[model samples]
Target chain A: MSTDLSRVADPGSIKLYTTEPDHHDPITLRSIGFWLYMMSDIMIFAGLFAAHGVYGDAYGTSKITAAQVIDPISALFPTLFLFSSVLFFGLAGVALKNNDRKEVLRWMTAAFVVGLVFVLQEIWEFVKLAQEGAVPQASAFLSDFWTIVWAHGLHVIVGLIWMAVVLIQVLRDGFTEAVVGRFLNLRIFWFFQAVVWVFVYTFVYLMGVS
Target chain B: MAHHQSSPIDHPEIQSASTLQYVSAFVLGLALMIVSCIITLGGGLSQSSTLTWIGILALIAVVGQLYLLFKLDLSKTMIWHTVSAVLTIPLVFISIVVTMWMFQYLEMRVMVGGS
Candidate 1:
C-alpha cells in the first residue's frame, strides 16, 4: 500500500473543529494563576498564625502578654498606607480596562509609593518596639508578632516588585492584550494582599490592643 | 497573506463588558477599604467578645473586597477556586484558635498546679 502521504502532508485539511478560540483567554488564565499563587501565600500566613497560637502564652517565665507588646496607635498609619495601596491598585485596574496606558503607569507608581510607605511605617514600628524592650528574642509574644508582621511586609515588597514589572510592560507595550492580561493578574494578586492585611490588622493588631 | 475579517478586541460589546467589570471593582474596593478602617479604629477598645465581633465584621468586609476587587465568584468556571479558598480560610482560623486555646489551657494548668 502506498504510504498515506495525503493526510499526513495536508494537516490543515483535517478540519479539527471546536467552539473555543485557538488561543486561551489570557486574562482568565492570568487571573486563575495569580489566585493560585495567592492561595500559596495564604498558606504561608497560616503557618505563621499557627506558630503564634502555639507560642502565644510562652513569654519565657514572664508576664508580657500580647496586649502589652502591640501598640494600636502606631499601627494605624501603616494600616492606612496599606489601604491606600489597595485603592491605587483599583485605579490601575480601571486604567487597564480603559486601555489608558499612561494612567496605568501612574496608578501603579502611586501604588508602589504607598506600599513603600507602609513598609517604612512597619520598620519604624519594629524599631520602636525594640527600643521599648520588645525585641524578637525578648519574649515569645514578640517573636510570634514580629514573624507574622514581617512575613506580611515581605509579601508587600514582592508585590511592589511585581507591580514595577507590570509598569515596565505597560510602558513598553501600551495596552496590548498581553500587557492588559498581566496587569489584571497583578491587580488581583495585589488586592488579595490587601484582603490578608485586613485580617492581620483586625486579628493581630486590634485584638492585641485589648 | 490575507488579513483577518474581525478581531475580538474590536468588538464594542465585549469592550464595554470588561470596562464595566473594572469600574465595579474600583468602586467596591474603595468602599470596602473605608469600611474596614472605620471598623478597626472606630470600634473602641473592648473585651475579647467585642473584639471578636469586630474581627467577624472585618472578615465580612474582606470577603466583599475579594468579590468585587478580584471578581472571585462561585460560577461554574470558578467553583473549585472559590471552594478551596472558603475551605482553607476556615481551616486557618480553626488552627489558630485551637492552638491558642491549647496554649492557654496549658498555661492555666501550670499556674494552678505550680501555685
Candidate 2:
C-alpha cells in the first residue's frame, strides 16, 4: 500500500502525534519506594533476629523453656488469621485490577479485620504466658522471646491501623490512582509481615519445642 | 500499552494449573504442619541433633509453601527476596548456634572450677 506522505506531514496532525510518555506514573514510583521500604524493614527484622539468636539462652536456669513459653494452641489462631489476610489482600489486588472499587474495599476490610484478630490473639497469648510465670524478666530466653514476638505483634497492629486509614480513604474518595498505589504498597507490607512470621514461628515455636 | 485484563480464575496462568495441584499443595502444607507439631509435642526429640533436623525441615516447609501456595516466581524482582531470605537464614542460625554453644561452654567451665 502506498502511504500518503503529504497527509502525514500536516503540522496540525503532527501536534496530535506527540510520543512523550506520561512522567506522572506514581504507581511505578510508589512500587519502587515500597520495595525499598520493605528492604529496610527486612534489615530491621534481621537485626532483631540476630539479637534474639545471640541472647536467646543467656539464662539457662529457668524452668520456662521456649517450648513452655510458646502456647501452640494460642498461636495457631493468629497464624491462620494472618495467612488468611494474605489471601484477602490477593483478592483485593484482583479487585483493583478489575476496577471493582466495592470489591476492593470489601477485601481490604476483611484483611483489616483479620489483622486485628491476629494482634489481639498475640496480645492474649503474651498475657497468658506472663500470667503463667513466663515473664520476660524471668530469664534471658523469655526476654528475647517476648521482644521478638512483641515487635512482630506491634507491626501487625500498625499494619491494621494502616489498613483502616486506607479503607477510610478509599471509602471517601474511591479508587484514585494514589489510593490504589498506597493500597498496593500496604499489601506488600502485609505480605512481608507474614513472611517474617513464618520464620518467627518456625524458629521460636518449632525449634523451641524440639 | 495494551492492557490485558482477565479475571483471576479465568487468567491463563492460573487456569492452566490443575485443581489437583492446588489441593495437593494444601494437603502437603497441612502434613508439614502436623509433622512439625509432632516433633515439637512428642517430647522425645529434644536433643540438639533432632532439633536441628526439625528446624531444617521446617525451613524447607516454609520454602515449599512460598513456592506452591504463593507461586512466587524467581524473576528479576524476586531475586532480592530469595537472596535476602537465604542470607538471613544462615545469619540467624549461626548466631543462635554460637550463643548456645558459648552458654554451654561457660556452664561446663563453671562446673569444672567448682569441682
Model 2, B6-26: lDDT tens digits are 332233222223334334444
Clashing pairs in 1: none
Candidate 1 lDDT over residue span A129-192, tens digit each = 7888888887777788898888888888888888888888778877666666676667667777
TM-score of 2: 0.72
TM-score of each: 0.76, 0.72
**In candidate 2, residue B13 scores what lDDT?**
26
Q: Alpha-carbon interface RMSD of model 1?
A: 5.0
Candidate 1 whole-model C-alpha lDDT, 0 to 1 = 0.68
Taking chain B only, the TM-score of every model is: 0.58, 0.56
List native contact recovery per candidate, as a fraction of 1: 0.28, 0.19
| Reference-based lDDT, residue A16, model 2 | 59
Deviation from truth (RMSD, Å), model 1: 7.8
Cα lDDT tens digits for candidate 2, A12-86? 555655588745345545655676666667666666766666566556667777656766645666667777776
